[model samples]
Structures are given as C-alpha cells and as structure tokens.
Target: MSAYKSADQYRDIAGRLALPSQAFIDGEWSAAAAGKVFENLDPARGTPLGLIASCDGSDVDRAVAAARRVFEAGDWSRAAPEERKAVLLRLADLVSAHAEELAVLESLDSGKTIKDCLNEIGHEVPTFFRWYAELIDKSFGKVAPTAQNIVGMIVREPIGVVGLVLPWNFPLLMAAWKLAPALAAGCSAVLKPAEQTPLSALKLAELAMQAGLPAGVLNVVPGFGETAGQAIGRHMDIDAVSFTGSTEVGAYFLKYASESNLKPVGLEMGGKSPMIVLDDAAIDDTLVSSAISAAFWNGGQNCSANMRQIVHTKVKDAFLDAVVDKAKALVVGDPLDPATDLGSMVSEEHRARVLSYIEIGKAEGASLLAGGGASAGLDGAYVDPTVFDNVDPAMRIAREEIFGPVLGVIGVNSAEEALAIARDSDYGLHATVFTQDLDKAFHLAKRLPCGTVAVNGFSEGNVTTPFGGYKRSGSLSRDNGTEAMDQYLQTKTIWITLK
Candidate 1:
C-alpha cells in the first residue's frame, strides 16, 4: 500500500501561467544574490502556488544601484516632461491592452474576484498613469511671494532614487499610486512588492520598460519584509521611501528612514474606519447599497473598508437588518468565477485570523447576525460573509482591523455620538457619512478625522482628488488630486540676471 498521495491531490495552475521567479533589476529578470526563494501560496486552496525569487540586502543594493544609475544618467527623469508624459501615457495604454491577462494573473495570485481584478487593471491602475501622464508637465512649481528684484519659484525636481514598498491588498493599484506620480515627477524607482503578491508588480515593470521606460529607471525586487523591506528603508542612496501597509510596520519604516538618512518617508497605514448612518439617511435602496459596499467590497481587505458602522439609535435596528440581509446574499467562491462576489483571503493564515476575530466578536458579547463558517464544499480559501450586531465601540472586533469579510455594527445615540464613536479609533484612514440632510452630511464630513470623507455615498474619487489619513496615518499626503505627484519630486530654485 502506497502511503503517499499523488500530485493530483492538489490543484495546479502552473501550466496556466509561467509565474516569474526572479527579481527584475535594470530591465532584466534574475535570481536573488543569495539564490534564496519564497513560496507564494494560493489563498483559495491553502496550497503552494510556486516559489518566487527571494531577495535580501545585497539584492536591494543592486536594485538601488540600478535606480541610482538611471537617475544619474538622466535618461528617464531628464527626458522632457512632454516626452515623459508620452511614455507614461503609452504605459497606461499597454496596461489597458493587457488588462485581461493582468486581471487573470492578479486574481490567481491575490484571491480577489476576476471582476475586481479587471476593474483594477482596466480602470484604477491605468487611470493613475494616464492622469499623471497629463500632469507630468503640469506638475510645476509655484511662484513664492517675493520682492520683484528677488523673484523665486519653488520648482519641483526628481526626488532622486525612490523606494516604493507596496502592500498586498491591492498590489497593482497601490503600486500604480506610487509609480505613476513618481515617474511623472521624473524619479527613478526600486519597487518592492508585497511578498505574497509580487507577480503583478513584476509584470508591470515589464510593461513600463516596453513603453520606453529606460533600463535601470525602474526595478522590481520581491523578498521577505524583514530583509527587503528594511533594506529599502535603510538604503543610503534612496532619497525617499513610500509605503502602504499595517500601522505597526509603517512605524518601523518611519523610524528606519529617520535613522538611516533622515530620508523622507510616506506611509499609508491601517484603519478602523467608521461608516455613519444618520437618522434621516435613505434606508431602503440607497442606504443599504452603500452599506453593503462599505462592509464587504474587496472581501473587506481594503485599508479604507468601513470596518466600524455607527448607526443612530433611532434607526439602528432597521440598518442592522438591512446590512445583514444584503451581506448574506453575497456569493463567496473562487475568484476566477465571474459571478463570485466574495473571494478568498490572501492566505489561509489571514483567513484563520479573520475567523478568529469572528470568534472574538462572539466571546465579547457581540451578536453574530449572519455568516460564521467556511463554505460547505468550496475547495479554496473561502470564508462566509459575517456580521456582528450589538457590538460595543470599544470591542476589539470593532476597533481592530480584521481584513476579512467581517462587519461590526454599533448603535449610537445621535449623529453627534456617531461622529464621536467614529473619531474614537486610533486610525483616521477613511470614513463614510450617509445622510439625506446636506447640513448633517457636511457637518459629519468636517467632523470626521479621516483623510477622506464620503457624503451621501461612499467616496468615488478619481486620481485627481486627494485620499489619505490623519493621525497615525503618515507624514506625507497622498491622492490629493495631482498632488500625489509631489512625493516623487524635490524643489530647486535658480537665480539669473539678463545680460
């Protein structure tokens, strides 16, 4: 009797796509300096998808050197803003051209639904580049107030070699957020993608090169967080480091940058955001639709996902019922399935973490309104959509980030109490204030201590609008319209006298 199971015991998509297993540096893909590798797992099935190149300190140096070379060469950053604009535009076009393939790959790797992947690749990802492309030349300096004889202009220049560390939640979208503006502002970069989902970023580097981004102008290195992430933070030649991840790690990078070179650090950290439903809010269709979007979209992994819901006591019961009903109706399954509304978490560990939080909710006197288990027959990493009612504002479930399909419903006495509860968290990433009254909406909007506030509906912002957080968020402002490009630039003033 054979004790071993056949290879067919597990699902395989290796033949579907030959995943890149190398660090992309100076326009070429190669193994890490140490010849190490990391296994990326399929979140849906809790199986090893494949081994990808794992880089460390030496690898980080190579990438930084490449970026530095490109910066010094001025082949990309020194190109005329018009020409740079053209290249960025072309890059966006290429992303659009490969939108289908990118979406499939992202879905396979990230465990997000194909529909969401398509939306990211087709819409969010490309829009950043396209918007920044036009803004390349437009991102000029403003003339500071000065005496006529002593005129001065705060001209923006490339921020030199930048290190962009992107999160796994929305790999392509987050990378685009950094890359588009950084490239637009004439900076070369070394991109370190989340180890869990590095495929899309490597693919994107290839696309950028094909669109005429010069060799060494961009590099992608995948590795462990302690190794590559820290290396990027401490690299001497790196002028700036922009990151999006948990607040715990963001703090580490912030300190690393300060200790390393006092290099400017941009961090977009964690959130326990509140979604306020006012007494006058439209409940039946519009309010329910917005609530569903806030709680469950993107599998509740979004940094800006409405984790905490504060409903006015008068309408709390009705709101909870509506939210639970809608959440229960969501289809959870394989990401490749077009109809699947909710996909698996990024990994089994994350899935377990989420479920544990659900358990915590129950133990802490919160009510499980709907969903609290694995799908009956699903093979991949599928967790049922879950909602908790009678949750206290102080409960761990309500305050901490689960990053799963779990919602915590809290009732507040009034809109003022709602805002107070919403503002009580350590995070100020984002919040949505739903109300039919304009005065109430605006009042709540101004009072909420988040980087972005959505009135009447969830925020549907374009690349031009600013999107960032307040306290404990980060040092730099991001997504503020064209201002996103500012992080990638430095300022220089030149004085001259006409002969």
Candidate 2:
C-alpha cells in the first residue's frame, strides 16, 4: 500500500490544523508566564506557522513545580506499575490513531519528509511507548543473602521530577525515546522541546492528558534554549536531566547541573561517525544505499550521522560511482510528497549554514561528486545532497559535524588505516563497517571504540539495544531498551534485622 496521502491531502490537514501555541502546565494550555511569544514558520515555504509560547525562566519554574507537586502527591509517580503501564499503552494507541495529522505537522514544521514522519509517528513512536509499558512490571528487584538474623533487599524507585530537553530533528520520536521510559518509571517530568520545533510536543501533552495521565504529571514548556532550556538545567527541584543534542550544548548541561543542584545529566551528544568500506566489501546496491541513508537521512541532521566515508583504495572508485549516481537520482522537493527522497533543511538559517560548508569543502580541495547547493525554484530551505571525494582526514569538512546533507569520502589504504581514521574523532557515538570476511568485520567492529558498531550495514540498532556513545559523544547513561529506565530510577537498599 502507498505510505502517504497526496500533497493536497496533507496541505488540507495543515490548513485546518489546530496549531498548539501555549505551554501545557498543570493540565492547562496557557500562554508563557511573561506573555512572550515567538514565530514558528513552515520551513518548506518560509511562512509563519504560528506563534509559540516563548517561555522564560518563570515558565520553567511553573512546570517543574507542577511536576514536583504531582510526584510528591502520590498521583502518577506513586501509582501502581500496572496503572502507569496501562496509561502509557493508551497513549500509544492515541498516537497511532492521530498518526497522519502528526506526520503532516512534523513535515510542515520541521521540514522532515512525510514518509519518514509517518513511519516514526505511526510505527516507531507507538512501539516505544508500548515497549516501555510492557517493561514496567517485568523489571524485578533483588534480594541479598545476609547474616542469619538479618534480611537485605534492593529495590528501585522513581527519581522524582526529571527534565527532558528534546532536539528538533526527530520531534515526536525523541519525545517517545525519553518520555516512554521516564513515565513508565513513574516519574513526573518537565519537557523543554527545542524552540525550533515545539508544536508537536505541546500536542503530545494534550494527548497524554487525554490518555488519563494525571494533571501535573507531564508538562511541556516551549521557548529558546537560553531561557527555557537554561531554566530546566539550573532548576534546583529537578532530580535528573536527559538531553540529546550537540556536543557543545551537552557540555553546558553538565555545567548547569554542577552549578545548580548537581542532578545527574545524561547526554547523547554529537558524533563524526565513519562508514568504513573495507577492501573485501562488495560495491553493490546495499553498500551504496546504506552509505546514502547514513549521510542523507533526515538531511543528515542526526547526531550519529555517518558523514565520513572511509573506503579502501581498492573499492573507493566503484563505491563513489554507485553512491553519486544514487544521490543524483534522489528527488529533492516537497516533503509532503511520498516521491520526495529528500526535503528542505529545517530552516533557512540551517540551509545557509550547510551551503557555507559546501563552500568550505571546495576551498579545502575536496572534489565535489554529486550535489552542491539549493534546489532551483524550491521555495524554502531545500538542499541537494552534496558528496565530496578525495577528502583528507585533516580537512575541516572531514573532521567537523556539519549536520547537513553533505557526505565526504576519505580514501584509506587498508582496514587498519580506516580504523585509525575512524577512531581519531573525539566523538564515538556510532560507526558502520562493511566487510565480507567474518574475522575482519569482527576485528574492526571490536576495535571501533564507538557505542554501537554496525557490521555489513548501517543501522543504529532497534529499541531492544541500548543507544548511546563511549567517549565525548555520550555519558554513562543510555537510552532505549531496559537501560533507558535507569536514567529515571534510583536503586535503594533496605536492611532489616529479624527479632
């Protein structure tokens, strides 16, 4: 079956959409505390979408206070695990029911393709909620053997109120990533959706309430990073923070925690991941598709985007030929259209930033292969997926995180050279290795130093596997699977003496 509705159908939904424009705090949709607002625009047309509530420190305080109140009052936070699970499961169903509306909203606001948005909103989003809900009661505590007269027990408890600062790239999916586990763990939360994309978050709050989530259990405050984000970071009442964004911004959260309440911070920061095509690997359609998806999916705005391609000299030519051909054939047009393989950058500013990097790649002597700049006659920030070959390991384009639809190919003489170049980055969130030989794949995979290494393909694994980084790319805390619950729970020990 076709994966999406017609462009006219999507536009009709957008035209009549009830754009959320306020903070959802304490079960009410209210304006910013200071009555300030910011313009949210349609990235595809550069037109004003709506006026989002420009929350400041005051709004953050209000949201956190409400979360703390509900948590302490034994509402959602103290509910039975089954109760929380049921509520979350219902929320998942609600998401699926409204999938088309949300997918279109995301595509219009964030400039993500409607097909991708549907897959996430319709399938992945609900799956995350259901997965965490199923895990709620299955998680077991531990008992310790002690002296004959004494008994010891270890159990987990909710970590109280948490701050979830989301990124703009995967608006609802990232919300699902953090919220599912946090809410499933029975912790109240204050969410600060990125100012660039906050409408879906506000809408999510409305849905959570409709799903029987208690008042004050979940809140969303929308505003700029310096105001709403900073307030959440420095809020003394918040018990923990889970952030997914840039490396530079991740550092600031750590500082905020240190300077404020010292709440633990979980960060999934940026990466300069490499897609290594070893000499033994085939230069077939699989490798080309994986390489293209790694670099161009979501326009390469992902934190773990494999913008660096370290291919062996033996197969570099064929790999480049195949990938460039595929890149050129990718349709760069309307995100609402299912045929559009690539869409606009999230905003005009981001498009300019990416175009500048293309200029930088040229100045640094990287050979342009396919794509370079804006798609002709496109209204908004649409960009062609640019590929560059003959990239040196030392060049800025190869080393930095451009977070655009720009891929650079660096030729490596051997698997060892590829490993060395891949490991040279300060970040180690993810890496992809393509090799037919089992021993070589295992060798490179084991020594890659990243959090999750994909063998023979490009993947970040499914919800069953933990996702995070090893070095500066992430912290000790992880997301997805059972590990994600650890971010919102605390382990406690109980010792008793028998009379």
Q: Give the candidate number with the greatest lDDT.
A: 2
The 10-residue segment with the lowest total lDDT in model 2? 1-10
Listed per candidate, the RMSD to the true structure in angstroms reads: 5.1, 0.9
Question: 1-499, model 1: which lDDT tens digit per residue?
Answer: 1121222221243246767779999999989999999998878767776899999999999998999988888898789989999999999999999886777778878999877888888888888898888987765577767666766666778889999999998999998989988888889899999999999899999999899999998999999889999999999999998999999999998889888899988888888888998888767777788788887888988888887888888888888878888998999987877668998988877888888899899999999889987777988777888888899988999888888888888887788788788989888888998888898888888888888888877764778787777887655558547777777777788664333
By TM-score, the best candidate is 2
> For model 2, which pairs clash?
none
lDDT of all predictions, in order shown?
Answer: 0.84, 0.93
Stretches off by above 4 angstroms in model 1 are: 1-15, 143-151, 497-499
- In candidate 1 the C-alpha lDDT for residue 238 amounts to 95
Residue-level lDDT for 274 in candidate 1: 86
TM-score of each: 0.95, 0.99
Superposed model 2: Cα runs more than 4 Å off: none
For model 1 the TM-score comes to 0.95
